[model samples]
Target: MELDKMDENEWRYHGEGNKSLVVSHVQLSIVLRLLKYPAEDSENPPQTVEQAFRQVQNIVDFSSNVMSCLLGEKFVHSGEVVKLPLEFVRQLSIKVQHQRPAWRCDKVMDIYSGCALCLPNLTSPTLHQPTHTPTLCIEIKPKCGFLPYSKHVSQDIKTKVCRFCMHQHYKVAMGTWKRRSRYCPLDLFSGNRQRMHFAIRQLIDEPQNNLKIFKGGRCIFSSMDGIEDSMDLNSLLHHLRPYFQYGNNRINSHMTSKALLTDFIQVVVNALLSAGGGDGGVGTDRRGEGRSFCEASLFNKERSRHGSQGSPSDSVLYRVRQTQMLDTLDIEGLYPLYRRVEQHLQDFPKERTRLQMDGPYNEAFLEKLHKCPSEDDGSLEYAVSKVHQYRVAMTAKDSQIMVALVPSCEEEEDDEGLPGQRQHRDFLSSRPPAFSYSVSILDLDPKPFDNIPRQLRLDQNIVSCYLRSSCALP
Candidate 1:
């Protein structure tokens, strides 16, 4: 299965085979080259080749354990769906530092733990006592997993309050309030502060809305992770066996895992952006837009085969650098209160997230892709041309992290001199138990959808019978 972010120029695929020997050799070679004896324009290698090799080996072993934990519940299962929780865009580095990894592995650091990465140092016992920075690869697991069911919404007092708190909470904590009365956690009983607390008080007064908070939902099931819940369709029909099913019956076997995973990942990426107003505008109803899977991708067919090519040599196709994309935007440079990101998500009614994927996985697209020559071949040109039509490439230069008010049972004491004073207990804090945020993919788990039951629901007799009536095919 191929996954591509044309905008970021990144791609990934799935593989299920054991190649430890080959992988280890490749890792060793990389280490040797990095720490090789000879010096170029750069400084001398920190360690000898043999030392580097051992470190690399240690890294590989550590990575395996980390991967296993990230996979979590899916580790032992086959055809496992994988999603890297950390969203930082730096390349994996082999730390030439003298100290070993604090945990099971060698001295290599958890990429998130580095002070250079711009993560906040939460001073709590939960943090490592020495550094007070998080040691584990902290990732946010999506509470609801996918988008909750909401299509149209008005900007209620609750939403505005949530946004105001989310956008301003950090500033208040840092003693950098812009609009002083907007939301002062200290003046909890004051007039304007009381008005700002209206939404919070409303939830506290009403029991129903309070219930949804624990369930990881709010007044509206906002479109998140790219599912324009505006899908008015009763149910999604997952077709198993298309008429042109290719060799080895690729549909029955491979279809269940890779294909679903491809769409799932794309949906999530979009949802995350939309939740944070990365869509740049309001969400659109994709189905209402009269869009259909070109080759019946998820619908179980091939992409329309048109012999065409897009700009194969076009260097700047989706040219937004990682540093620029808000998804991976550096946090250290960001200011908590003055952070200028897309605000007022409730302004849009329908989900504004755009669809990135063209169609689900199909052999024809793959075969045509594989047949393409190194340069501009007819097959490649055709695939690229069609891919262009999936979704209009959109970029936002000023996107910021999405944070909203969350309901929590905890509260921070007003005492500033206390040990936990820096750690705010209010609902506005981004740190968890009481905040809803769509900042980065770090907050999401890459768990695969259960397709076994969906596949079993498919029967050849039912498919053929339905096809005969619908398409009049003999």
Candidate 2:
């Protein structure tokens, strides 16, 4: 395909992360994900053309071959690696510069590297929706779902408190976040519909880094860089009401803001709960309250019991919770193993990059992990094996769940009847809503082998700070 003729201007900034910038093609159902790196850093310089190609190729292959096996294959897409002209990359970078969040400008797009990842625009409204049918895409960064049950976990607090909750204190102390978000991963991971709804409500209340609302593949609401000014509820509701009201004229005319917002949140909740394939039988009429972040502790035995028992074995959240259990040794035990692996790798550097494109764990290794070892088999081989499993689990923990909702076009509206009024009633009979939805897992990048030590230190800091603060007291 002649990518140059597509007009660099057609590519608009979609969203970004610490490592890459994603831009969507206006007229096409695709997006180009570009890598990002330091501007003048000597240690981490721009990759050469060959290196850049291999890097993106590695990502594609790893996501396709490895992550797909861990997460469901239907939810994971390993897009093709496309090499753009350097000039085209440069212009596209410049064009989207103004659209990026201010704080995210630190690491600019790799203008020197021509390689880009071409992915299907999962949230594309033009391709996925009928005319005047607005599409709502909810991006949820559901952090680690389960607390450490490993005996090797030195800190009793780590066993009692989830990593995401403890990290909130650290974030607040660092001034990186304006305040602590009440959204707990445990609550979201809890299979109970009420708890899940409550968790999503908390996210909507304070989106900070974890939740984002997109309309037509463009970010309409998010707490960009954890800024205080981005928490405008009125703006979020305004953007959401249009999509909810577009077809059902009767509901649109009479729907209050409260009802509209509830319906919107229900759509997202329905998508998440239905991950196992049912119509997510959760109701949206009555709002469910939940324990505060401070009160929502894993130490609460009743809460923990419900989480373990209430969750569906086949659901996506259940799968993630199970994947998270790979860290059976926790970071405490994983650290020693990590050091051993590092030393061994240094001793035999030749084995460091074997099957590198397949990510840290191979299919055989992953299958063994899925079997769940019965004992704390402490050996160099065991450590090596579990470390890879731990890394894969970490990737799953940091991944985002993209829930896309578009009005279903299966039934044709009667020619003599109102546009969508008659169809809206038919759509809401027994299911959550008339909308057709899709759920996909995103951000499947492999964590570096060396990040284990950094995690250990961060875990220490988070636990220490939380204990020192007043929030730690039960």
Candidate 3:
């Protein structure tokens, strides 16, 4: 889609006549800057795709707390709670063939998400009603891993191992083909001829061996800079252009992709709602509840050295750490963040009232509250409590990670002509590749300095239950 000229910070888009949407785009790397310690452009972000998803999930969830705070007493009058759908429309330089060969757009919309809305919890006054319309919309851009740098490995002897593929490269003395593994006989030797020794060197040379791997580390992505942003867009376009077409015979809409993306947006919104009531990023425990700093890695590395040795009363470092050990909800550190988002909304051209929240269960409870003009039956208090429960509850039931299995291999002759090649072969080529995807709703970002496992457990239970459930997910 083409954008109209406005200013450096945002792109003003048009839908119907006199109606427009102003979108401010940011990079994923920029979001990393929000972390305790952001990585430099020269260095890679320490986390993998899955880990990054969890980090984003945490941030989205924590942002929900701000939404809850914004809702405040408004929940009773306005009868709503605001929710953020992490469906951030990111601008990237993905290749798209135009009427001419190379017309470049300063930005193109991707599958990334980060949109927030304060509406009714699927209930209360009822969202999109006669009185409530969250007209203001602001986009927060985080510099996530959009385009990654591809490592150029030399084909020399030392860099024999390729990150893209794992083709076996060993032969026995009798000309028999076999991979050199720990079980191989040739690995028993030492020095230059040792098979196991070479493998060990190769292992050490691989990038990101130190980082934690998920699911038995089968989906290792830290070393491999993943397929590029353009590749993802291109794949999406390729999937869309078969039947559906726009003007001039060019396919414009892909129904399957559009539906899946919509579902992905729900995943993010639910994640944020989940974060609000659970712990508010600082649970009952005082540890990790104090100050929230932008620097986590570099700053901590230096301060931690002398922080403990100094006296708590006299030493500045000790005082800082000691203060940090207390409750974070007691601090005003999150005030600026909340204010900034509101300021952006206020500056927008639309008229927006106080923020609110929304979701399935929240909506039902709000409906009950709206009907009960009094609390004589005690249902009003119970309904309000249910709203809170819905806020902190997990969202995995709505957003689930899916596994799509596609055929990646076909039967082929072993041209080398091994003895009974035609009838029954090694079957390596026929092996199917499992579907590995980055769930729109990743893991939770735990409260800083909090050693408690509660948040982690909540996040894990959501995913585990989804996997175990018979319900279908998009």
Report the lDDT tens digits of candidate 3 across residue range 1-474.
112331223221211001111122221100111121121321443555455445444444433432222222111111111122222233211211121111112222222322211212111111111212211111111111011111221122212212111112212212222322212111111111122223222322332211111111112221222423222433433432332232333334434555433332222222212221121232211222211111111123243333222121211111222322221211122223233433544586242222222222233433432343232243323333322322332221111111111111233223332242111111112111111111112111223312123433432343334333313434
lDDT of each: 0.21, 0.70, 0.23
Q: Which stretches of candidate 2 lie over 4 Å from their true place?
A: 4-6, 42-46, 125-131, 225-230, 245-252, 276-308, 355-378, 409-432, 471-474
Estimated TM-score for each candidate: 0.18, 0.85, 0.18
Per-model C-alpha RMSD: 26.3, 6.1, 27.7
Q: Write the per-residue lDDT of candidate 2 for residues 415-451, one digit (tens) a residue.
A: 2223321111122222334666666777887787778
Residue range with the least summed lDDT across 10 consecutive positions in model 1: 14-23
TM-score of 3: 0.18
* Whole-model lDDT, model 2: 0.70
Tens digits of per-residue lDDT, candidate 1, 92-165, equal 23322211112212222222321111112111112111222111111111111111111211222211122223
Which candidate leads in lDDT? 2
lDDT rank order: 2, 3, 1
Q: Candidate 2, after superposition: displacement of residue 404 in Å?
A: 0.4
Error of model 3, residue 7, in angstroms: 16
